[model samples]
Target: MTPSQNFFSDIHSIISQARQNAVRSVNFERVVMYWKIGQRIFEEEQNGEQRAEYGSFLIKTLAEALEPEFGTGFSARQLERFRQFYRTFPIASALRTEFSWTHYKLMLSIDNEDKRAFYEAESIHNLWNARELERQINSQLYERLLLSNDKKAVLAVAKKERLPEKAEHIIKDPMVLEFLGLKQESNYYEQDLESAIISHLQEFLLELGNGFAFVARQKRIHLDGDDFFIDLVFYNRLLQCFVLIEIKTHKLTHQDMGQLQMYVNYYDRVEKADFEKPTIGILLCADKNNTVVKFSLPEDNKQIIASKYELYLPSEKQLLEELEREINKEKD
Candidate 1:
């Protein structure tokens, strides 16, 4: 390279390295400061006889003092949160540098320790920002994981650093398709649905869960002079496989499964590299006959899957009933 090019490259490297160090230094300082603040506030609250009243007064007084000087972050509610943060994660050394104080603030709201830890570990591992962390938490990622896998598997997948074995580890069923904005009674063609999903691809990916990168929409595959267009194609880095999704506006049929199987086979035979795992096919339909799905695929089927989607969140009563039915089925 030219002298000028080398000089510029060196300057760029120096700037980049400096910026990274500055960020790390600032984050470490802030985490330490917050831990100390939390400790002080907690200790002051506990020292006096009117501890309960003092806790309330302490946050309010601190907020009053800090907000005018430091700005919007130090509201009474947030002060309380910082105190709770200290209570939840006592050790300053244990604070994750990957996340900011804002991220921890959001996590403190999660009542369940296990659920909070799972989100923390996953967020740090995935390098998620505060907003992404909040979205995943509000999206009920933990609940969806529980529904999809056994508790042991869920814990292992979320807590362990290793990638999960199957696509099911990261894929969520009955994925919330609220972003499509299609009303319950609105009639939409397959193309229309495809367009909606593409337009709202980011939200859809979030609902699809982690590690899915969009490869194509209306992805075409050619074989033996015939052309087939899969509705959606995604690559799951965690599973090390291609995911072929076929969208259906109506109840799933045997034909739908067969067609998805063909697409999966084509990908496995042609598109996939020797090092990549076998392709997975998912049928996203309005409804599915579980019995038919169980029997439709081969007895040893390990890739193809059919799952129903919902336009909006189901009612609490409906979810409870579904839970009860699942429990009863297991009992039988």
Candidate 2:
């Protein structure tokens, strides 16, 4: 590229950055304004011992007075949201400027305090927009992580208090792929799934969790006179290792685990650097049997993970069932 072209690119980037900053500043001001309004409303409500009826009447009166002058933004529903926002985040100083009011509004729906904190810390760490935050919440990311780890450990990793010592700390099981736009009933090849993931790579990364960077697709390896192709390949900075994912349209079997183990062995022997950790392999299948997986790998194995993929988001009932199953397995 010419020097003028490079200079123009730099100028364009600067303009974009400035515009983003302007938007952030406006959002921060709006969030603070709502917070203060909530604080005042709470303080007024606290004056009387019968806060239930009094608070309800106060909000209705305020809406009646304010909505007429200031428009629908001051409607009763909005005011209640503001009040709840303050209640949720009691300390004004604890509010994050990086989060928009929409972000907090979404989080306000989450009743679990630990779950809320995990999402808050993750949103700040990953710089998720309101949409991404909503998606993660809807997909039950916290619950999925909880399947393999405790609540405290999940929150600790998200808060960056300590780095993820292993891939399972960040990687989730039963990965959601609703954004891929593939219908659950549709018959598609492995390549189709791979293409869809590439097309929506940003969303895929979000679903894959943090610190992952795309490396290669259908990565080829040669041994002796034969050639082998691995599916999606990613490097996770948090784990400091290569993540090899192989998509299987059918249920996972012991043989499939061996194949992935071989691929992981190849990467660890040839591609892994002296400073990098052992390569991790993930068998992403449509279905998997926990018993088969357990007996297939070594007792101390940590490098290989088997994750099931769904074409769409699982319903609440389905997720609850899965959670119960995981809990039962842990007990055993």
Candidate 3:
């Protein structure tokens, strides 16, 4: 490399490292400050004769006084959040530096303590940003993982002790494909859905869960003088594998599974590096027949997967029913 290139590369590396450290330090200090502020507010309120009135007035008064002098970040609502932050995580050392105040604010909105803790730990382990954290929480990632895996296994995976394997780790049921903007029961072409996904690619990536980086759409693979185009291709950093996705507008069939398998095999043999993990194939169809999927793939199949996708978010009732079914299947 040229000297200028080497200098720029080193500078970039230093800047990146410095930025990461700065973020961690700032978040850690801010959380510590908020916890102390909350504790102080709580103690003062307890000691005050008019506890209820005092608690209500204190934040408002503080915000009114501080906003004029200190500028932004001292709103009444935010002060209340700081107070709650202290209550939620009383220990300063327990606060995770991976998440910012915004992440904690979202977490505090969750009512269930156990669920809150799970998200918190998972966010820290996954290094998710505030938006990513919010998406996972909103999607009920913890509940879904619990439905699919044992409680112990779920906790372990959340803690990053045992990493999740296969498509199940990354795929969310009733996927929030609001990006597609296609109405359910409306006649839509596969090309239209693909176009929508491309248009709102960022949202689709977020919905696809963490670690997925978009590689291509309609990626062509050549084999034996024949060419086949895969609907989508993504690389999962966490799984260290290339994921080949096939979009189907109708119910999944054995032929769809076989096509995906063929694409996966081609990628594994030709495109994927020797050091990379096995390629994973997914058939994202409108519907899937579990029996067909099971019998279609080999008995010892480990690399290929098939899943159904939805154009819209499912109701909580539907999610719960699916969870129940998964639990029953696991038991059986």
Best by lDDT: 2
226-305 per-residue lDDT for model 3 (tens digits): 98899999999878899888889899899988888988988888999988899988777888777788899999898777
Which ranges in model 1 have alpha carbons more than 4 Å from their true place?
1-32, 45-76, 222-225, 313-324
Candidate 1 Cα RMSD (Å): 3.8
Backbone clash pairs in model 2 (N, Cα, C under 3 Å; residues 3+ apart or in different chains), count: 0
TM-score winner between 2 and 3, please give it: 2
lDDT of 1 by residue, 1-332 (tens): 45798898999999999999899779877877877888889999998789898889888999999999988777887678778878999987788777787788788888888888889888876778888887677656676666556766766777775578777677776676766888877888878888999999888887776688999888888878999899999998878899999999999999999999999998999899999999999899988887788889998898988877777766545554655565676577
Quote the lDDT for 226 in model 2. 97
The TM-score measured for candidate 2 stands at 0.96
Model 2, 73-103: lDDT tens digits are 9999999999999999999899898999999
TM per prediction: 0.80, 0.96, 0.73
TM for candidate 1 is: 0.80
Using TM-score, give the best candidate's number: 2
Better of 2 and 3 by lDDT: 2
Instruction: Indicate whether candidate 1 or candidate 2 has the larger lDDT.
Output: 2
Off by over 4 Å in 2: 1-11
